[model samples]
Target: MEPVRLIMSGAVVGQELAAEFGPLPPSLLPVGTQRLYELQLAALGGTRQHLVLPETFELSAFDRERLVELNVEIAPIPEGLRLGEAVVYALNSIGAGDTPVHILHGDTLIAEPPLSEADVIVGGRRSNEYAWAEIDTDGEGRITALVDTRAGEEGREHQPVAAGYFAFGSAVDLLRSMTRMRGDFVAGVNHYLAGHSVKLARGGRWLDFGHLQTFFQSRLAVTTARAFNTVRIDGLTARKSSQDEAKIWAEAHWLQEAPPAVQVYCGRLLGFGAEDGKSFYETEYEYLPVLSELFVYGALGRQPWLRILASCEDFLRTCAGITGSGSGDAALKALAADKTLARLERFARETGFPIDAPLSFEGRACPSLVSIAERLVAAYDLQSGAPESVFHGDLCFSNILYDSRVRRIKAIDPRGLVGERPTIYGDLRYDLAKLAHSVVGRYDQIIAGRCRAERHGEDFSLAFEPIACQPWLEAALGDLSVRGVGGLSPAVRAVTVSLFLSMIPLHADKPERQKAFVANALKLFLQMERQ
Candidate 1:
């Protein structure tokens, strides 16, 4: 059987309908009413649909553009008296000859299931008995005459009720009747349907978005969906090339972007150099590609190195010290702080994953973890007055990316402000924590695989080593001190231990990796306590 042909009317019928219904009352409408038509279309497999709207109804340019993008056919009808009459006339003009047409309002989005053999299917809630008439009933509790009781309740003493939708078996006939009846169009259609047997299909949520309040609520719903699901391939690809590219894209286009001071602070902390002498726009353009690639690849599970790089970049930025001040600035700062860790934590909790257990360190603990912890405490103890610089307060895995092809790393999303040098010095341990957690958590599996692969003595570097981690950490920190934020070791041992402890559960899959993380965290905590 062919897909059902859907015709939508009443694009802005809600405004007038709501006014007619009386004063606006606040209430949470159904979720279906608040979602955008685009998302509804996606849910129903986009195909075989036509939308009809009156010219009087004002639709945003963006909405129109979106309709076009979704390949929806839009037909404009003359606006004036009996807008419903105009819509029926348009549907009759365009529908397939004599075919049963499914008519719905623009605000009503339905999830399309395979069509049943019934001649006509009308959907409504069984609970809305007063507003709906049970014309026919099967032996079972099934309903058949669920015709719209909208007009009956409209201006009545009872609470207002509406079917908000209708379906017709005789599309051509309904159109003709609508044109002739004009002002009495809806009544005529109901009269016509009364003579014919119509099947009532119960189920599906209904939303009425015919008011300013409903419209506002619907906008928020749409924004939430766009923020989470919208994909920008170009933006993602661009970020992989450079840190600046990712920063620009995240700040300017991505729903998340850090504030200017925070952005500057992050850069300084991460050893991105002073924003004073640099071209901000140029730097962002250069960085976006790198950041994008790192994010996409990391998400794809193609590169493990990104775990360290991203952590390091973000840590450095946060240590530098970029803070949120005003509303706009706060928004930017939040944008820069990558919330991946929080997201992962939530996901793990929801999925019932054990994420709060202590990690098991193998026979040997990471020496670097101890050394880094001690150094951090010493730096913090000195109370060295470091120059104020910018920082990405939430430096975590999600904000950083590592490009395997170039063997380079980049950072995106920054938060606080600090001296450039101090930011770098303090942030060095972040990457080490990430690496240790990953290696310790996944240690057994990685080692097993490496051992199997190197049975014939082939090279393998799957192990996590303090020796390897230290170089990158030191280099990044040193660069920040020398070129960006003034050199002041602001590294806090407590923060380092906390970071390591957080990663323990994430590395649960690898016992050795898990162990390493625990060992490191314990050592760091001990060092901090001593200091």
Candidate 2:
């Protein structure tokens, strides 16, 4: 079949033409220049002819040159002619008797091939506004109406078929009919076809670059289609120009601020390490410390006063305790057998801490420790069971922030059941044990480093040395007779050891390492039982 001749007319012909005239170098074409060069190549493939009309530019040297090169003809319509009229004039000048003319508006860019079977092809719905409305029908899909308007409706109910491109069997007949009707060529064609048989071809992807917004939108679409990776540093500037003022302001004001790095880093590490160790350890590990520093500064170090008060409260309320109604000895035996206490005892043993060793009954391991903790609670109960309170369930170097400038330790990341003085006393030793275990291997190094850095280095380590668990344990558990709890400390130690042992599985790369960690934790637990 002979190729179809494409004709286009519009006001912004210069800017919108190349997008429609496929495969032409944008830089080579002049404003308002007919892209006959590209059309000639397309004609060689199958298209028959091409034509363009710029209402203002009548006959130019560029037009004549393009006409000669394209082996086509040109006609200059008078000024003040509408695009539809100019299209009719161009169709007539080309001798409509010989070939089928395909009329396309300059603003439309064809991204796909035209239909081969249809005499008239139009683009499909490209936006929500132009969506086809479905009618409630009894039968399968059929074109029931060219246009339908409901009562009191402001607009037509049928889908709006855009008149961007259309072809006719007889160009002259169509043009003459359009001229006689005194209407736009599209309306004229639709009117002529009011009674005639016509077929509708499904449309392809057609982009309209008519307005400034659509022009940029189309450009962005094209860039995305071509997979061009373009980055703009001023995203807000581009967004503002695109008329998203709210988003522009939001991004400028809120989302651009620096985030807490430590939390971000730790969260990432936990997620990544759990999900993909090869990826996390090899690629993401180096950046963890840097991000963690931000968290330390912002959340941990900056908020010491809050941490200290909270820690003290938690210590008073959850860590101290009391024997309920039973014989203090029996209660102490049960406490010693408790799994949580056994775990702590095991933890002390595996980590090489003195908390797991046999005690001389009166110290921390004695039954009196529980009675003492309870008595401390009873004292508070006498004073209406209220005391200045705060608590950090997990109090340790990991959760505590040491402010070098102020020489104060701040606690963080509190957890556990918080309540009155008795309840707090019940969980006191657990917190202390947790703190002591956390500072095991590196406590001296950290204290020495801090002391050396202080200007008034009046043996700061001495003050911290007194706070260690050994003295506290000895004072609390001195003799076996008064030891209120038979195996409470050992049980707590076992639980702590089990938890630390479980952590090894998280960082262990080898199965043997994990097995070893578990075996060692079990041995520690058994030792707690013996104690």
Candidate 3:
């Protein structure tokens, strides 16, 4: 059968839920990386689909632009329609002929494909909570009559409820019949039920994300599904890893070439894991790519290394302004108040390093470690917040893979969270801090257990052999400043300090490494103060 035109009616989704996450319309609320409307379109599996909206609804420029990107055609319901009449008006406006039209509620999420052999199929599920649609089906499962079961309807408790999914073979006749009946689509369906043959598609996984409770629950469910799925690609085993890695793998393929200008040498998505919980999607493995940590530790030219950082920034800048991501100011305040500093202080005390011990960098005695930490936290708290962008949460040198022959940089293991939530909006300063740790903080050596910290009388010192990325690092900073991607030096420094401090808790079992990270953060805080 030919593909049908999907009519997604968002007019009935209501304004209360549309503005739940922010000012974002219901259609734009993010499910994973994509939005609710985008997911529906993907489920329909066509080039484009029809999006129906209320006549009074005004589309934001961003939303309109995104709809254009998705190749969606908007159809609006006429103004001054009664409750439930808007969907019928919108449907009648389609001028449906012989072609089948699939009607779906925009707020609902149905994972199963629109696969049905019957001329008309109404998706439903048997549940105790819902006002069940008591479906009377024939021997072939063709629905005879749909009865709405209410609380007082004693015997209809075990019936299947219609989930707002329908397929119509003759849209013109059905819509015309609905206009005469003057009711909701389901009411209209019930009005013409005697003549048309309707099939019941029952027991499919579905969710109506209209209110806050259902939306949040469905969001978590989708996130969990996105997090852990198997991947299968030819000549490669997609091993199960963190959610961040899986998202990065999918994103890398979406962006076939790394931005600014470099090829992305990462796996391509093939689907779910063949081995249970091992992976989410598989991809064709690129052979002989050098892990960037090994490449950076080796004899690499400064220009190529600088190019990778520049290209990374280019990619990040393009992915800004995702809807429902939290405010930057709030996130920065949370970061400053996070338990990382407390953990660092504990590690310092356990390692026999006094918090009030004099800290010196470049032979200049400045403030004590405790004083520096307090000042930095205070400074971060006073900040106005940085501009948000799509950041590789862990952009350390190790997560990058460089193909020497192809001259590409494939980034792996993205953090996928903005603030405490899984979102794409994050302060660029966080990413900058991560990259800076590899250069100035010597995070790689610290992780390798090569970093050492010592207490001499009243002074504490940290020592680590530096890598050869200094010249490139300088170039990167200059590029960021020139390109206006740099937020503020003080904010970046505060974030960098937090980055090192946060590592202390991550290495709690390794007291030596924890001490080194604490010392590193203290030194960075002091340097920021000097600056």
Candidate 4:
């Protein structure tokens, strides 16, 4: 028996897509570490392929090399031909004579391939819109009539639509079907089903990403699932994007060997529940053992505050020890040149505030404050000409869990690396800056919605629930000053203060609180400058 040949059709120039992203080939549209066409190829288990291109298509050298690697033959359809005619033209060029062939659309993303052993296999998904497939299946799961919507009102009732995946036992039959398909080669698969016993496959998720909106949606779904291993639970209010917190909970089972007892309940994923179009990461239903958040506990007493500080100190020291090697200069450049500062300017415009101007804190505006802050940070590099180590990317108070029973503090939701790059050991200063927010910047209260900004034209006054543990803040700063990198310098203070400012544009969930954080950080910067 001859090996199956995969034929992919993506030759047409999507006019709207061309006007925006570029008039590039559809298969080259990027998604997660590879092109969309590469992903489609990966989904199929064929060694040989025939990829059809448009008459006006131009292949890049890189793409050509990739085609050579994949054992693919490029077949360009001529101008002024319908899709069916183009497909026929490509097939005739290959002289695909009676070999088993699989037909696929390049613009679609399939989560998994439908495996089948039959004369013909047609991948169909439940859909109300687009081409509908009226499938008459026998008790043995063999399709009798694969009627298209063009078959009139009776055929329109087909609930499962063929969303661009077809298989044939013989290319001779497929060629005959292509001859019959006068137009719209995609929908033409319906005509090809006449005489062949078709198997309707509903094996995995199928998404049509031909349009811009659906393309983004499909990308988000695929990437999110890949990153978080999302498992939506029933009767829970968790969203797909909010699975980071759940990930911490789910991963605790593996990360729970060390002391401090981070999670009270950690276990394997039981199962996910998807109802009403909402999903939740399903784990064994158990209450998280949290007496109170470290923020609330710190506000209650001085001893609790000290304990939280010590716990955080210990946890950070542990993280700092898990070091690795990378270019310190490169990491510092990435951090210092992060686009948050530009976004800060945009945020000022959108919120009608002068973020660049001196902020009024404790009834006084420090002279040349924003300029001074910028100069101090700009003059110094956080990496300090040495490779740094792993640090919790977001060690804010909200991310810290204080188990008072064990008198231990735990951190959650490490901001991992940026993109596919290992940003894990970029700079220790970023982590220190975030940690400082809880003490000097009053981030705990700010996150709890106890922050507000009063704007008067070009000036603004910010108010936040005052940070109560000044001595604890001083001690923590002092400890970090002695042990952390870029130690206790003017640059360190500026970076810490700037972290708060940088965070203001990030919190779309609570803009008022972010403004307050900025104010608090500004006040700290003024004090540091005066010293």
- Most accurate candidate by TM-score: 3
Estimated TM-score per prediction?
0.36, 0.34, 0.46, 0.45
Candidate 3, residue 293: the lDDT equals 32
Ten-residue stretch with the least lDDT total in model 2: 282-291
Cα lDDT of model 1 overall?
0.39
Those runs of model 2 whose alpha carbons end farther than 4 Å from true positions after fitting are: 1-4, 13-47, 58-75, 113-115, 126-160, 224-531
Most accurate candidate by lDDT = 3
lDDT of 2 by residue, 112-181 (tens): 4354533454534434333222222214322222343343344434444553656556665667667875
Each model's total of backbone clashes: 77, 70, 12, 5
Taking all chains together, the TM-score of candidate 4 against the true structure is: 0.45
For residues 344-374, what per-residue lDDT tens digits would candidate 3 score against the true structure?
5776766665666666654557566556656
Ranking by lDDT: 3, 4, 1, 2
lDDT of each: 0.39, 0.36, 0.57, 0.56
Over the stretch 303-407, how does candidate 4's per-residue lDDT look in tens digits? 656666676666666655655677544554455445446656766766765656655665667533346446555644644665556555666765565555566
Q: Report the C-alpha lDDT of model 1 over 1-531, residue by residue, as the tens digit.
A: 233344455333333333222111111111221224554456445355666655455444434655677776666666554644755656655655665655555554445432443344444443322334334445643333333455335332332223334556666666666666664645555555556665455434444344443443333333211222231222112222223333333333311244453343232211122243321221232221122222211112222333444445454555345422323222222221233245336535654533443222233223333243333334332333333333333444344434333443445444223222112112333333333323332222222222111111111112332222334433443334322422222333344454554555565556555444445454445444554
Clash-forming residue pairs, model 4: 231-280, 231-281, 232-273, 232-280, 233-280
lDDT of 3 at 274: 27
Instruction: Predict model 2's lDDT versus the native.
Output: 0.36
Native-to-model Cα distance after best TM-score fit, residue 346 in candidate 2, in Å:
72
